[model samples]
Target: MKDQAKLASDPADWSIVETVDAVCAGHASALEVTQAVLDRIARRQPVLNCFIRIDGDRALETASGLDAARSAGRTQGPLHGAVLAHKDMYYRAGLVSTCGSEIRRDFVAQTTATVLDKLDNAGAVDVGTLNMSEFASGPTGHNLHHGNCHNPWNPDHITGGSSTGSGSAVGGRLVAGSLGSDTGGSVRLPAGICGAYGIKPTQGRVSRHGVMGLSFSLDNVGPIARTARDCARMLSVIAGPDPMDTTALPVPVDDYEADLDAGVTGLRIAVPKTYYFDDISPEISKLLDSALAVFTSLGAKIVHVDLPHHDIIGALGNAVGSSEQCTLHDFWHQTCPEKYAPLIRARMQAGFGVTAVEYLKALHLRSSIARAVSDAAFGDADVMFLPVLRFPVPTLSETDVGDGAGLHEILGSINHCTRPINYLGFPALTVPCGFSASGLPVAFQLAGPAFSERRLFRFAGAFEAANGLSDCVPDLP
Candidate 1:
């Protein structure tokens, strides 16, 4: 096992640029890069517990085959030989597809997820499965089923979830990129806390065919990567209609990497002045101010907007999510309640109490809230900018661990800026903005209306290029 501290300090050793350059120049084989990732997993897994399972032998075999084919002048896909991992919630045939809960710990999928198949076809090798929040239920990243995933930046701090391990793995540089499911900021919140880039695509933009569903209506799968270009590359492979999922839109895939260098000139960016900024830490607020300044310098018009129904959006999102989750696990809870974590069982039980009328009312409120937010905040802008999480990452020791009032407050605060977008089914991207005073990372979020992913990427990429923040990497243990 390699020393993680040594690997963490050596930025040049971990840069994706060097890995790709080596492969292209024939100085290193993709098999070798894959092997290195596997080796790092072995070295770091004990301390990080980032992976649920490591298919090192299969990964090496596939990488070697790809290298041999490429050497023989055979063409490969865009992501040829890139080492990748995904949250364990993604169903890969014959692999255990646990949603980080005891009930489904041994559940195996007969078929692979659409996103998994797409990535494999693109020539990305799956090295392992990353950890995640149980059933994608909580936001603080504490999982009673598989232990909490610690932040790579500061091990004492929490890695925001339910995409806990996906964020930690990418932040820890254990793999090139990973996929995480975001229902209500599962992807972006962790990415923000861990200093990575994450995208929560529009609902129905990507197929949810084989993913473990928490909320069928709000669930979205997206990439978490070290850089914006890498995320775009992965999205290119995974973004398309799937015959298995009728709800998936047949939207055309655009090249997210093409206009990355193009500045955000003549772009209208909205900065909401109400709920989004309220109760945020002063340091985080300052970092957002600095980010807005960078956009202003890049010739983007920044306008202040308002969202009055933000509180309603949050409440409605919880109602919808809890109801959907209850429906998914009703049989399991009824038959084998002991298998579920206590907190999850309680949450699932709460759904049973929601009346049909209440559910309908919540749905109606969701629609109205979405319309109000769109009209007030997004009417004049290409996208709206906000924080991914309300504050810096919390220490693992400090967050609530049980289903109590403190736990609710912790979870709600973590999802404060994110739940509304999920309820509205909008697309969002989170990119690192600056570091907190304690040296933890803080992120700024950008969101737009449905199917506005390309524009979101364009604006985010432009902001990334101008700020040059992605170059900052954390020192791992």
Candidate 2:
């Protein structure tokens, strides 16, 4: 193996795939690629605190075995030498899987999550576990159990979570890619704030088995990467049916990497003049307007649509999510209440107050709203464009006080434009559009009908290509 000490001294030399591919093609082993990522993590972890755990020794062993097998003319998978990270909520067998809470700090599953197994089978090296919001609940990336993960773009600002570390680590270039869960825009919010690409795949499109549940109805496992193309590539591997998750749809996986350069000509796109554009900073509004202009310039027909009852969807989404989350953690709450974060505990407690009749009514309301949204916005359009979050990341102090009323107000504001689609179970992509005046990243989302990730990705990939925003990386201190 190449000298680990030398690789540890230089991380940028092995940060992107283009660099690793060139090195690997010239006989650099998978072990070398894995070591390079470990080396980078060593350099980055202290500053970013993006990872909860680092298993470099074990990763090196796996990489070396794969390299040895390949040396004997054995075939490996598509992501043969790629190194990736997963959110701490994902269960990797024998690894301590802390779902960013004291409740499950010592929990280790006997079996790995199907998504992790799929990535491993595809020959991707698991470099480490990224940080996340406790119980995958909050919008701001504050973790009372682990320290708050700072945004790479601006360490003083939030990273947007429950997928906090996934966004930060990838944006900070600590890892090439990472997996994140989205319930109420967890993945996309972080993607927007941290200047990364995030995909919240359609619910049940990817298996939720082996993941710590936040909201059974709304939780989605997806990818966060530096570019839309990278997100697509990772999705191709991690997405598919899993017998362990009966909710997983039996759909065929496509070659997401192919035809990525395809433009969005002739596609109908809509901009909803509703909750999406309300109350956001004027700079964010202007940035989104500029992004929409790019779509118009690329031959996409821009249409104006309205969803008058959009506000109800956000209310109903929170009710359903909170109720479901409470149900998932009833035992923990009853058995060890003190272990739970006060913020999460309060929200979970609110769930008990939500009656079954109300939960069922919320579901019915969700369906009605989804149908109305589809007919009004997506009836003639391939994708809908909107702001990912109404605002950019706030400071850590603002979010960490466990002030339930203030946190709810802020989270509700951030999820105002995002939770509606989660209620409807649609796929959404958040790509960086511009930066706020304070140098915080801002992003706009592309939402598509159920199982229309390909279409959404095509549109986002084109927008990314034209905008060339992926090249903007955070200059970490």
Candidate 3:
């Protein structure tokens, strides 16, 4: 093997695929890689505040075991030797899953998340848990409990919620990849703002067993990684039917990485004529236009689609999600209201006011709305392209709108670009298209019909390969 110190330094810059290849080839041992990752995390965590917990000892132990197995002539899985972390919400039996809140600050899980089990089987090393929004509420990464998760690009900028640390850690190169949950825009928002690739798979594509619930109807589990292929590798391993999570669809999981190399030859990408871009800033618009140009250059056709029901989608989605969240936190909200952050409490209270009629109506209309929107969007296209953020990345101070004053407006506007897709239960992938003038990242999300993750991966991979932006990392020290 190469010098241990040199190997460690280089693997911090390696993609998940590269890390796996090197470890499997015996070019580097898993122990060395885990140590390198821990060292990087130690240096970066204080500045970024991305991790809620760092299980260094556990990670090294896991890595050493993998190395021993490999030395014994045993084969490893796809993610063998790939060091990863996750949102603090995903449970591991007997481990404390804070869910980024003081409410469950010391709460120990009785069972492990299905996704974590699958990752272990795939040979991924878990270093620790990342920070996130309390109870996965809010879109601005304002965690009054665990401290806000800052953007790696600039510590002052917000790192989109509630999968804040997943995005920050992955983009900061502290880990190879991370698993994050998205109720509305949690996964895509963070990944986009941090200049990484994240995919919110179809509602039931990945099992949610042992994961904290925000809005069961809308919550999705996905991965954020440096490249589309890395995201694909994680998704392929974590996605599939789980007997533990009845909500997981029985449909067969597609080979998400299989068609990644296949360019978007004649694929049609739909651009909505209204709603999505209604309030976008000129700077963001230009970047998206350039991204479209890149897609066009790669042989994909861009079509203007008159998407249906854009006006009511966000409101309806919020109603369903809020009601569900309130239902889950009703007891604690009623008794221990003081434990929650003001903004999170206020956000949850909106759910209580949503009557059963409104809640049922929202749930009842989901199927019809999804069908109409999907038909309109996909009638002549393979996937619909939309902005992840309508404006440039905002500073933490600007978006730290506390509980009572201006919370709804700020949170609503921040999540405007991603909520609609969650409402429709479609899959969307966040691809970093370019950087903003302020040096923050801007991204576009490509959304496709339910269970179309493979198609989204292919398109995103092609764009990433062409633009070569996925290789860009934040200049954090």
Candidate 4:
């Protein structure tokens, strides 16, 4: 093993697995690793604006305790001493969870989130809360509350959101992994745009108890990390049925890391014939083709299929999501509507016109739509492939539609490829595929049937092994 100081000297170069192995085996003390990360965060946070808070003192104290336990010969979990940050939504008892809104700027949680509790029990350290879209409403990463999170690749460009901080922080190597919720494209979009790996577990795969609610019917919790294996490790720790969240699926959680090295030798990957590719730019299309070529070279078969419901899925998903958002913020809408950013407030009000019958109709059709799409998409394939963004990563100025006449259309366009999956309750993984003409990252999403996260991870792992894109990180100034 390398000298403890030398190895821990640059925490950015270490993966979550490598960090854990070093801390557990005494190659580096947890406190030393934590200090390295704190130093890195200190340097990067000012430019990236990724974190809403920096809990350095608490993180160091916790890491010191973990080191003492290791000296006492206590067994450590897989995460041991890995430092992580999460979108400012997950609740920790007695701690402020801003949720990226002035409405709850000082809101302290009464109970801890189930996912955070699980990660804590697994020996991970929570360094702080990452910035996010106010109330997780906007898809463009614009938070009038906490300044927009800048992309590490180009500070002038936008870091896709509402998981803006998670993606920026991880891509900047401030942390190896972080938790981000996906309501529409929160997890996948930021990760894809920022050149990292993230997975939106199937709806109900991870418990949402004590997490801020966005759209109950569409909200999902997942992790964004530097590599597929890191994302897999975090997912394995946080996914499972919980007594606190009755919506969490009751099935046994699969050992996500056990099948990571299993390559996609004979896997069938479906490519959509329409909708997803409609507005894709030539550069992005070329990159997607190159990615497909890489898969073919690896012995994976790419099959083209005409996915059903391309025309209505987006609108239906919006209906369901907006309706639920309105319901959750009903009181706030009435009392302090002025507190919300105009764009978000208008977005929430879009639900006001949804007749009860219309909302019910959307809910009633969810299962049927999911089944039909699954049959069409996965009927002859193991998983479906789509681009995370149809165009190059946009700059903050380019996407800052604000409360204009085109707000809905702009926001809708940004999340077109990802929201439908939430409606279908399927798992999707985003892996960096290439860089765009502007030098920003481009990525592809692999989605599978409900609760098929293992397959998504397996497919992503193979791509990461082949392209080595996961090893790529933006040069931070």
Candidate 5:
């Protein structure tokens, strides 16, 4: 096989973009890529437990069809012949979609997700489903039903959750890219821990029609991949107005990869002064400084910005998320609460007393708060940068908050930089910067104004080129 290097589950193995080009140009066969991915999954899944299901036979069959189409001189779409998997939350018609809960263990979706449909039309192969937090509730990647997804960089470290499998699979190179939902940092945290790139686009930027709802207002559908270029390719195909989702923004989707090579020549970047760096460890702080120096070397100017209402913004997000989750699972909570995990059950219960007036008031403040964050960030900068996680990625044993000792404090700290941006309805991209002393990766998030993904990718691409960070795969020989 031409892509024999793909068998290692190493990040430097293959490219989603180039794979599509080669297959469509008759230079490579889709079946080969699928076989390589299946082989990697076999080797890596046992160690990381990243997948809930592996549809190897069906995936190989699909690849064979794509190969025939290419031989017939036909091209599918921009993503033609690329292989992928997604968080089990995304629906696929006629397939069992376990949303990481015992309550939905046998639930099968009747309609497919719009994002999945877009991907299929683009010629991307759906290999299987990845693991996630039980009901997408926790922050430290724990799932009582499905097994926890371990970090690929260090198997003992937690893979930041709800989108746990998405991060581990991409970082492990079992597939080129995967769709992950981000409601309060699910996508960002795993990216940081697993040493990969993840983007949570603006609220309503991607359709959530057939996606299981964790929070109708705060949920975002985005991509996790080895590089920003791969993410840009997937995001371009999945984003835009969708009739199935009324909340999808009507904004015109730009060619995300169009300006990725433009560089950050005159771009303004921000390093926050508060909340993000609060209580951060010395190692992470030093790493952030070094990451900024790389951007400075790329000709971007750094400005310091702060959000005094950041904590409030994050609290509001949590309040809304919990209340919405409780509202959706009311029947289950009332009758089958035992089916849920103890930690998430307690969190869901926290929203029971949220008065309608309180929830409404919180919703009303979102627009103003978004404007406040935007004003502070864009006043002197185009993008705001901060560490995705301030503390080191703890062992799975260190984060079992279900036992209730400091439960709130422990879970709250993991989503520090992530939840605030979701509440603001902005875009944030986490790119691996370096590894921590414990061997897990450290990352910095680049957040931009609403729907500015192109600008974010441009800056990220430039910094990635300067640092050569994503290409540093784990030595999985």
Candidate 6:
């Protein structure tokens, strides 16, 4: 499998597919790719605070072994030698899975996360776990415990959370990609603000076993990368049914890249007329309009659709997620409430005030709400167009919703467009479309029905080509 030339010396310049091809074909050894990534991490870590730790020694050892296997004329899997990391929530046996909380700061796991296992089986190297918002609760990237993850584009601005490190690492080109769990817009928010591509598959598409549960019903495991194709490749490797997780679907996983370039001709794309664009600034609105034009230019039909309950959908979903999160962290809340961040602790405490009848009602209404939103948003469309953030990326101090300086209103608007998708349990893709006035990244979302990752990727890949935004990388000062 030897080839003509090596990939770039810096892993920051290589995408997942490029690294895989270069390593497997002998144009570049796995160690070379691993070393390049480690080097980039070393250079960027201090500035970005993206990683809680770096398992550089283990990554190098793994890379050397993979190189040996290739030399012995054996290839393990599709992602052989490609480097990737994940948020701190994904457990690794014998390693600390902080879940970005003081309560579990020193806690190590006895079992490895199924998602991490799948990535290993596919030959992807796990470099380390990333920093995240405490227990995946916050929308902004503020973490009093682990330190906030800084945006690579402008460290002063927020990276968005709780997948802060996943987005920063990929957008900063420290690694090809990383895995993130989205209970509320955890994955998509960072992907948007960091100017990267992220996909949160259907709730049942990927297993959540071995991953710390924030909101069991709302939790979803997915990938964040520099492009939709990279996301598709990772999703193909990590998605599918798991015996370990009954919530995982029995439906077969499709080849996400198969039709990535398939023209969007005659494809129906829906745009919401209700809550998505409400209160958004002119700059963000203009960016969305420009993106819609690109979709039309790609021969996709833009159809108007409105989810009448988008307002209630987000709030109701929050109530359900908050209740579920309380159940998961109940022990800690009862025994050592002092361990949690003040704001997160308060939210957890609020969950107890939610009576059994209220929680049951939310759960009972969940299905009907999901169906209604699905019908309104995806009933007649192949893909739905939505906004990620309504305004320019705010400074870290401005969006600290816990500080109680009018940030609640800012935080309220941030998730109305994303949490509703989680409630519906559908797959949503966030791809960078343009930049806000502050020069921070701006992105639009495309979602499809349950387990429709292929359709989302097809649209995302097409829009990526038309928009030409994925190739732009952050130039950290």
Best by lDDT: 3
* True-structure RMSD for candidate 4: 1.5
lDDT (tens digit, per residue) of candidate 6 on 2-121 = 323334446557888888888888888889888888988988999899999899999999999999999999987888998999999999999998889888899999998888999998
Clashing pairs in 2: none
C-alpha lDDT of candidate 5 relative to the true structure: 0.87
Winner on TM-score between 2 and 6 is: 6
- Of candidates 3 and 2, the better by lDDT: 3
Ordering by lDDT? 3, 4, 5, 6, 1, 2
Preferred candidate (TM-score higher): 2 or 5? 5
Runs of candidate 4 exceeding 4 Å displacement: 1-9
Please give the range of 10 consecutive residues that has the lowest summed lDDT in model 5. Answer: 3-12
lDDT of 1 by residue, 282-401 (tens): 888888899999989999999998777775777677788878888888898889998777766765677777777787788877767777888887888889998887777789888755
TM-score per prediction, in order, is 0.94, 0.94, 0.98, 0.98, 0.97, 0.97
Question: Between which residue pairs do clashes occur in model 3?
Answer: none
Q: Stretches of candidate 3 above 4 Å error?
A: 1-9
Better of 3 and 6 by lDDT: 3
| TM-score, model 2 to reference | 0.94
lDDT by residue for model 3 over 137-243, one digit each (tens)? Answer: 87888898899888999999999998999989998889989999998899999999998999999989999999999999999999999999999999999999999
Model 4 lDDT vs. the true structure? 0.90
Clashes of each: 0, 0, 0, 0, 0, 0
Task: Give per-residue CA lDDT, model 5, range 1-477, as digits (tens).
Answer: 255454333322677886886677666688988887888888888888889989999998988988888888888889888999999999999998999888999998999999999999899998999999988888887888887788888888899987999988998777889999999999888877888888999899999999999889899998998888989999999999999999998999989998889988778998888888998999999998999998888889999987758768877877788789889999998998899989888877877788778788889999998998799988889999988998888988899878486988888889888888888999999988898888889999999999899999998898788889866777452
